[model samples]
Target chain A: MKPLTTGIAGIALLAVLVLAPLGLPPFAMTLLTEAVILGLFAMSLDLMFGYTRLVSFGHAAAYGLGAYACGWLLLNTGMPMLFAVFAGALLTGIVGLGVGWMCTLATGVSFSMLTLAFAQLLYAISFKWTSVTGGSDGLAGIPRTVGPFGFAALSSKAGFYYFALACLVGGFLACRALVRSPFGAVLRGIRENEAKTTALGYNTRLYKIAVVAVAYGLGGLAGGLYAPFAGFANTELLFWLLSGQVLIMVIVGGAGTLVGPILGAAFFMLMEHQLSAWTEAWALYFGLIFIAFVLFAPEGIWGLATGLATGRFRPASERH
Target chain B: MSTLALLLTQTVNALSQSALLFFLGVGLTLIFGLMRIVNFAHGALYMLGAFVGYSIAAWSGSFWLALAGAPLLVGLFGAGFELTILRRLYRRDAHAFLMVTFGLALVVGEAVRLTWGSDALQVAGPPALSGVVFMLDEPFPVYRLFLVAIGVVVAVAIWQFLERARLGLLIRATSQNADMANALGVDVKMIRSCVFGIGCGLAALGGVLAAPLVTASNGMAATVIIDAFVIVIIGGMGSFLGSLIGALLIGFVQVFGNYYAPDFALAFMYLVMLAVLVMRPGGLLGKEA
Candidate 1:
């Protein structure tokens, strides 16, 4: 009964998010679009880090790769938006698979560092490879094509907002379904205890690689959507700092819970907006808040709420 | 030949660069090895040391006092951070600690920017160390030689301390097996805090020495830390000797790479790290066990 109520509440919140563009001003709609895309990106990261216990610090690589793929396809091949988005995500998945193979060989800090190193390499390539990536100026003038559902137009702010909303909803639903499946159970098992899962004859490494690929692919989809809407894809997306931001969002919102990432993404974006507006030294304040969270609410907002409701702040099964 | 002189100059430059790299890399390696924390704010602390040194020297017109006082001040700040924020994160996973420290780096960078107003500043070398020294008929900065000497002496001192001192043995034991060391009444927590302070102080000392060579900027910390991490990883995470060798190798690689393709030097370093991992997962000087 509690789960059902939570599910209904989630749907209500998502409905509000989807309808927000209808009534909000143009600038507000644009912010909504960014929030939706970042929310999807955050959700993709949590799928692997939260469920699989693989701390990846190179997701920006996949995101950048996807954006470039879509931008490249649109400019060179004049492909449709629908085909371009999926194609971009496919290319990102391939790259993710390759990087994940290398990452799965190591664990703990080495694994995190390897992913960061690989991403850094990609960032360097993107910056140097001017012919393809626009050499830091980024690819501009990305054509906004009609939506796949045959909507009348999507070049307008409201149209694109709706388009972004659809993508976020689709991605969020797909993620929820994926986690509820048998594969997700195995991933959870692997997260809880890799040794026991390996002992049970499950190929833990392969599962990790596969899930990472999926998560990266989804993240790439978000990036691909972002390119047409924002009309540019820069090398900055490949930076490790962007990856760090995603991790912050995941941990800040509460990992493992399906709705947690959405809340986390909204909160992170909103906090940045408010803090930066208030002072030039917001980064310092941001750091202080993050430190406070690490010390006090390490379980994050959703974790804290669930803990309070259940009257168990320290669940043995949910030990980080 | 002029080409010969240039080649010799590059080699001399590489040696000095290696010293600078070693000074920072060794401190990072010690922290990572001893405390199991990545210390992402290390570069920021280094920057602070440089700024502190420059301020003191500029005010008092005494480079010598700045050399000694900068590191002490930065070390106290590092110690305070460890006690106030970092200690609580000791039991958290490395990823959490990494995020926390990364946040700390951001905080420190912004604070530096607020204090310095984002302007780049250069520190002047002391009069005695100013001017050029002849290295096989090629002129090299004399301060560069001083940096190398300092690096060598510090490396030797650290090597001796880790090998001969009682605290060093405890650190080694704690790093290898924290539980066993705790069981043996080694005061593991105190050792970790002290090691962190020392590690941070070493980074500050490097910054003090490096201030005259490199311009102080808020943005340099992140870039320097990335380079330092590459060197540390290549040298083996916790090995002091590994850091020295790795820094020299990386220094040469950077010099040669910049000569060949200036744009790809950083990428070339990553490729080298990948190659090392493939050939030997334990890193160059890392233990196989």
Candidate 2:
């Protein structure tokens, strides 16, 4: 898409999101809030998978850690909400740095598997350490606080929705800036040809670890928003299944495009909500759709839309 | 029992667990070796096998029939899936295979839940093997010993088959150099399908054996797939013997870790994997990256 058109679309999307809560019912508002949070989560995965070509099957480890940290802080310390979110993101960023360092040592499927193993370790801890993490029941009764002004009682559906929307927009802009920067160019270079990047005198490993940490920190920020929105953090968030879900969103929306995952997340969340309402066997249908998407439209919905708009279909090789 | 006896019993328990894991890991490695596709649905196939085994045993009152029937059925399904779906994907990005197989896992898991319901189903070991035997002043379940024996025999058989048999030679040749094997008139496509079927069969066989112990349930697929992947990763992705050794290592760690520190048993397993990854990124038997 051209820069002008992209800018217009961004403004239009922002307008819709800003006005959504005023017109929409409380239930739809809640769904939109969750969708935005999940969209940010999917965007973080895209930074690593789409841009860096690092398929992290354990991305949820950082995300869940963020949620758990935020939840624990709110429940135990009674800290201000913004402080809890910052603390959660900081803690997750540190953990991400450590884990991403080990993970960058390998590449390809082995790297994916290693990330998965680390996530599972974290999941095990959360599930077993009942005293601190609330075990399988998860940490509950988290209060929702918004902004530096210390606005409590943002637990109302519309209030939380707007807060989440603000965070999502902020996150999207930050991610867009990061991806368009020179560092993102290096990441793209590494993705296209890591060996070539290394031969070009670039330290690809250091770049990969740095990008991973940044992606994970963003994931943590999303998770921080998630804890207050949901009022609890569960171990399921750390499971590989959640990682797979985000991956599906990235692939189904459009991997390389920044806006694609958000579209994908919104599509998936809405479809899931609608499907489950229609049938209990929603996963079966969802699986079929996922398989069809991978087979037929590997570039995803965003790719399809762009192809239609531009009168040309770019193959996966030529995509961003 | 003395502490020594308890430790011995746990060691025996670990052996049986390792045997079960070997069944899943070896098959996974074989498929990956030949096809270069990580079969995420292998766990779902295992779950299907357990469900099939449960039904067969429940209806016919014959544990032996279920043991033979389940793997055979799932193996055929695996071959069909390869012919229908995976055959078209070989030319695409490797990530496509992972996504499709993961989708298959979701479909299969959901299908299992729909068919069997969400409740766990129990299937007893065969009557003859249900008894207990004293070992090291501890009464160990005879079925577990039988599982260990089966594991050893199967490991030896697999080794012998891969080393000595003509078809096995064809499989090895194809995996080693598919283009060369094709140039030499070997039907590489047929070999790929066959290997995939065998791999799925091996996973199913593990499920059938494990059903009596772990019970047949939808949750089994999730846990077993991760463990199977860990074994394959630690053993070397495509190395058969590496899978066996990796399984044994994981099995011992899990059993001993559970005994000593239940809270950290799973974490300990992952720690070992990380250590191996740091020391040998390709795994113990994996080729250098």
Candidate 3:
């Protein structure tokens, strides 16, 4: 896309998102907030997956950790809301660094499996350590506080929606800028050819670890937001299924594109809501759609849109 | 039970658990060895097998017949899946295959849930195998011993097939180098389908054998798939011997961990996997990365 066109599109979308709550029903607003939080999580996965060329099967670990951390701080210590979220991100980043260090030792499938193992381990801890994590019941009754500078009480639906929207937009811009920087160029190089990048005198492992930490930190931030957004943090938030769901969002939205995952998250959440309301066997239909997407629309919904807009067939590589 | 008796009982339990793990792990490794595709639906197939076993036993009133029939039916379904869907994905990114199989798992799991009402279905062992056997003053279910024996026999049979059989040679060749095998006039596609079927069959067999112990349940796939993946990782991906040793190690760890620290058993198992990867990233018997 042209720079002018992209800029206009971004601003227009931002306007729509900012003003969406005024027109939307209360339930829709709630869904939008949840979608935005999840979109942020998906974007974090995209940092590693779409750009860094890593497939983490355990991305939920960072997300869940952030949520639990934020919930714990709010429930136990009486910390401010924003500070607790920040603390959650910081803790998640550190954990991500450690996990990234170990996971980056293996590439491809092994790396994915290793991440899965670590995530499952965390899940087990959360599920079994009921005294601390509230077990399967999850950490509930997290007190929502006023936004920074006492701007708005996030306990209110519209207030929380706008706060989540702000976070989503800020997070998206930051990720977009990061991916456009020289460091991101190096990360892409590693993705395309790790050995070649290494031979070119780049420290690929360091780049990978750095990217993983950033992505996971962002994922944690999303989780922290999610806890108060939904009024609780459950073990399900940390489950591998969430990781898979976010992955599907990334793939279905369009990997390597910032706007795509957000759209994908919205599409998925809306579809899920609509489908479940229609039928109890919504999973069967969801599975079919997922399979169709994998088979036919491998580039995802955004990819299809871009392809149609450009009037040309740009394979996945050239688009990047 | 005395300490010695308890220890002996746990050992037997570990062996039986090892047998089930081997069933799940070997199939996973075989398909990975040949196709380099991780069949995420293996657990779903296992669950399907148990459900099938339950149905057949309910109809025929013969646990033996269910044992023989369930794996075969599931294996056919797997083969059909491979030919219809998976074959189309072989040329795409490896992740494509993983995602598709994951989708398959979702479909199968939901289908089973809808069909079986999401409740755990019981399948009793055959009357003959329902009896108890005494070992060192500890009474153990004969069914468990049967599982252990079947596991050992299956392991040996697979070992021999891979070593001495022509079909196994073809499978090994294809796994080692599909292009080279194709050039040598071996039917790579056919071999892959067959391997996939066999792998799914093995998992089903494990499920059928395990149903008597754990009952047929929807939740089985989630737990079993993770354990299967751990076993494959520990044994080293794509190595039969690695899978055997990995299964045994995990079985012992789980059994002993449950005995010692029930709360931390799963965590302990993962810790061991992490330690193995730290020491040898390829797994215990996996090929060097």
Candidate 4:
């Protein structure tokens, strides 16, 4: 898409999100809040998987850590919401560096397995360590204080909704800037041909680690939002199921496109809500839909939408 | 029991567990070795094996029938899934394969839950082997010893098959370079299909064998897939011998870890995986990509 068009579209979407509360009921407003948060989480993954070619199968570890850390802090301490969220994200980023270092030792399947194992390790910790994590029950009754936003600015439903929307827009811009920068060119370089990137004297491993930390930090940011929004944090967020779902959001949205995952996350949440209401075994149908996307619409929902707009069925195929 | 007796019992316990691990991990490694596909649905195939075995056994009143029938049936389904669904994806990149297989895992897990009602159903061991044997003045389940014995036999058989068999040569050749193998007049497609079948059959066999101990449940696929991959990653993705050794190593780790520190046992297993992963990213016996 043209830069002008993309920018205009982004602004238009932000405006719509800003005006969403005017139409949405309280329940729908809450869902929108969660959807935007999930979109942020999906965007975080796309930074690595879509851009850096680092397909982590254990992304839930970062998000879950963010939620747990943020929840624990909010409950145990008197910190406001914003600070706790960023604090949670920062901790996740630091840990992500360590995890990413080990995971980056191999590429493809091995890297995926390493990430998965590390996530399972965290899951086990959360499952057993009842004193801190609340074991299987998970940390609950977390405060929803918006921190510096004061008691009224970011505490209520509308308050959190605006906060989440602002965060998503902010995150999208930050990621867009990063990807447009020289560092992003290196990530694209690694994605296309890591060996060539390395041959060009770029420390490809270092770049991989950096992207992982950044992506995971953003994932933590989303999780941080989630804990306060949901009024609780739990071990289910740490499961591989969440990782797979977010991955689907990325894939079904359109990998390598910043706006794709956000749209994908929203579409996914709506579908999930609709499908589960119809049948108990919604995952069966959800998996089938995901498979269809992977096979037929590899570029994803965003790709299809743009293709329709541009009179091209396979827009990504003829791109640079 | 004395320390020596306790150690002996634990050793036997580890061996039995390793037997199941070997079946599950070796199948995964074999498919990965030949096709470069991780076969995430292999765990679901294992779960299906147990569920199918449970129903068949209940109907026939024959544990032996279920063991034989389950693998055979599930194996054909695995090959069919490969031929019909996965075959279209061979030209795609590694990530595509990963995601597709992951979708398959989700689909199959849900299917099993729907079919089996999400309950853990017991599949009894064969009456002939259900009895216990006296060991170190302690009674040990004969079925477990049977598991250990069969595992060794299957391990040796598989090793020999890969080393000596003509089909195995085709698989190894394809794994190295499919185009070259095809140029040599090998039916690459058939071999790929058959290997997926055999690999899934092995997983199903493991499931049938494990049903008595763990029971057939909705969560089996999720848990077993992780354990299987842990063994596969530790052993190396495509190495048969690596799978065997990795299975034994993990089996011992889990058995000993549980016996010693029950709370940290799961964490301990992952720690071992992490340590090995950091030290040798390709795994202990896996080739560096």
Candidate 5:
């Protein structure tokens, strides 16, 4: 019954987001598109980060790789849009496998560093591989292709916005199903106690790899879609900074909870829009807000909302 | 080029680069080791040190004042971070900490831009360290030699401090085994705060020293920190000796990589890190692996 309510709520939220671009200005719609794409990317990061206790600062490497792959395929092979996106996901999966393999050797800080190193490598490659990547200028003019239903000219902001929103919805539903499955239970077990999980005869490494691969694939899909909308793919997307942005979104929304990242992505993008408009030192303000959230809302926005509604906001010590 | 001169020049260049690398890597490694925080803002602190030095040099017309004073001021700023923010964040997950520090980096970087404007600042070396020295019939920059000397001195001082000082002992103990250190009655919290300050101070010094070497821009910290991460990874995290050796190795890679293939230098660093992780996850001298 609870899950059903949550599902209905989620659908309602999606409807609101879909309709938001229409009422708002064009600039707001553009921002909405960016938020949805980033929200999807953040959700992918949270899948591994929140569920498996594996935090990757290089997740953007996969996302950026996906963008590059899609753009590259579109220009070079002129493959179908869906097929190009599929190719991007495949490439991103391969890279994720390589990164995840190295990462499994170390836990905590070492894992983060390894992922970062791998991502930075991608950034460098993108920067230098001018012949293929268009170098620093990035691969621009990625032709808009027909969706499965046929060509509808998605090069416009409105078409891309709907496409992005649909992708976010589809991806979110898939992730929710994956989390509810037995595989996800095993992952949560591993996250709680790796030693105990391993003792239970579960191949923890395989699970970790599987989770990371899925996250990478999804992130890649988001990135690939993003490129054509932005009409470019730059090395900037592969940076640790982008990874940091995603982490903040996940944290601000809530980890381990499904709807948190979507809310987080919206909050962050909107906050940035408002803050940047008010002052150039918006980052400083954002940092302060982030610190406040980390200190006060350890459970995050969704957690806090639920806690308040349930009358569980009182201190545990005071409960006695 | 004469073999003697070329080798001498390369060695000097390596040491200079190593000094900059050590400044960036050691603080990063130490902070990570002690606080269990990645301190993504460490590079920004380094850049802040350089900008401070630049302003001081510009104002007082004394390179000496800038070199000596900027790091101290920056160190104080780092201490402020430990006392106010990082103290509460110590027990959080690495991802949260990373996000917080990353935000801090963004804020600091923007502040730098606001203060210094969007242009690069020109900072020169002291008169005494500005010229070149004849080495094997070739001239090598004296400033580079000074950098080498400073690197060696700082490295040695850190080595002795960690090995000999009571505070250092406490920090090493806390980092190696926090539970055991707590059992032994050491104030783990105090040690971590001090360690964070010292490490950030060292990064600040590195920035001040590097002001003349690289373009002093607000975004300089981002590039420096990334390179620092590569160096720290290669040297093995949490080991002082590992950081020094890693810096030297990376410096050599960068120099030679630039000569051989300029575009590959950054890629080359990542390749080294990947190779190291695959071959030795614990780093070159890391005891953990």
Candidate 6:
């Protein structure tokens, strides 16, 4: 999408999201909060996957670490929510820097497997450290501290929803600026042809590692929000299934673009909510839809929307 | 138990576990070797085989029949899936294959839950192998011994088939260069479907063997798949010898790690895998990427 059109569409969508809580019931308002938080998570993935073309198979590591750290800080310390969240994100970024550096040594599927291995290690520790993580039952009653001035908004459902919305929009703009900057152009070059980029004396590995850290930092920010919003953090947050779930949202919503994955996340959560309410075997239906999208609508929802606008439908494969 | 008995029992445990891991890893390696597509549904196929084995054994009143029937039926089902869905996907890149197989895993997993229900169901060890044996005054189930023997026999048989048989030669040739083999008159598509079926069959075989020990449940796939990934990474993806060696090493790590460091057994395995991956991305015995 062009900058002007995407800007307009984004504002219009933001307007709708802002007003949605007024019309929604308590349950729906809560669900919307969950969706927005998840959307931010998916957008973080888009930063690496869509732009950098790094298919991280274990992104949940960053998110899960953020959740655990944020939960731990809130429960054990008297830090404000905002500070705790920032600390969590910063910690994940540092970890991402190290893990990403090591993983970037190998390319393609090997890189993916390396990422997965690290996440599995974290999952193992989280499961075993019962005292710290609550093991299987997970950390519970995570206190949500109210803001810079001890405002009560962080404690309420509607208030948390707005806070999450602000984070999403802010994160989105940060991502947009990152992708449009010269650093982002280097990332795109590396994504397209790393060998050529390297030949151009661009230190492609450093760029790749940089993006992974930035991407995971934002992912941590999203997870930090989740711990407070959900009032708990579980081992499942770090599981590979969540990684796959977020990846599906990014790809199916339309990778290579900033806004696509957020929309995809909202669509997925809403559909899951509706389907699971009607049938226990909703995954069966969801899987079928997912398979169909891979087989047919390979460009994903955003691609279909843009294709319709241009009035030129094309069958595109899964290409970076 | 004495120290000798404890050592003996854990060795047996590790060997049996390695046997099951071999069955899962070898097939995955074969598929990866030929198609370069990791079968995410391999674990689901294993779980499905166990569930199907349970139902078959329940109906037939024989554990042996399930061992034979589960793999055969699942293998056929895998072939059908290949012919229908995967045939069209060879044109796309690796990510598409991963996503599609993941979708397949979800579908198969949910389908199993719907068909067999969510509760774990036990499959009795065959009565012929149900008797206990003592080693150093420690009683051991003979069925686990049978699993080890079966693993060795399958490994040897697969080795012979690949190293000696005409079909094995054809498979090797195709894996080396599919287009060249196709140009020379080998049916490439047929070879792919056959390999995929064989891989799924091996996974099912592992599942049937494991059912007696672990019981049939949906979560089995989640646990085993992670093990498979660790093994694949350590053994090197697409390397048969690498998988076997990797599986045994992991089996020991998991068994002994559980004994010595019960808190971080899984972590131990991953740490080993990470060390191997960092040192040699192609795996211990596998070619360097």
What tens digits encode model 1's per-residue C-alpha lDDT throughout A266-310? 788888888999998999999888877777888787888777776
Tens-digit lDDT track of model 5 for B148-191: 99998999999999999988888889998998999989988777
Off by over 4 Å in 3: A147-151, A316-320
Q: Measured with DockQ on alpha carbons, how good is candidate 1? A: 0.58
| Pick by lDDT: 3 or 5, better one | 3
lDDT of 6 by residue, B117-149 (tens): 999999997899999999998999999899999
CAPRI-style grade of the A/B interface in model 1: medium
Per-residue lDDT of model 5, residues A53-140, tens digit only: 8888788888899999999988888676767877897888887786777787877666777888888888999999899989999998
TM-score of chain B of each: 0.94, 0.98, 0.98, 0.97, 0.95, 0.99
**Weakest 10 consecutive residues, lDDT, candidate 3 chain A?**
A311-320
Question: Which is the better candidate, 1 or 3, if ranked by DockQ?
Answer: 3
TM-score of chain B of 2: 0.98
**Compared with the true structure, what per-residue lDDT tens digits does model 4 show for residues A1-320?**
56687678777878988999999898899889999999999999999989988888899998999999999999999699878989999999999999888899888888988889989999999999999999999988998865464665788889889888888889998999999999999999999989999999999999999999999899999999899989899999998878878888998898889789988999999989988999999889888888887889888888887777677775344532
lDDT of 6 by residue, A234-318 (tens): 9999998998899999988988887889888988999899999999999998888888988987887898888887787666643
Superposed Cα deviation of residue A206, candidate 3 (Å): 0.7
Query: 2 or 5: which has the higher TM-score?
Result: 2
Name the weakest run of 10 consecutive residues (lDDT summed) in model 4 chain A: A311-320
lDDT of 4: 0.89
Chain A TM-score of candidate 4 vs. true chain A: 0.96
Q: Which candidate is the best by DockQ?
A: 2
By DockQ thresholds, what CAPRI class is model 5? medium
For each candidate, report its DockQ versus the true two-chain complex: 0.58, 0.73, 0.66, 0.66, 0.55, 0.73
Q: Rounded to one decimal, what is candidate 4's iRMSD?
A: 1.9
Model 4 vs. true fold: TM: 0.97
RMSD of each: 2.1, 1.6, 1.4, 1.6, 2.5, 1.4
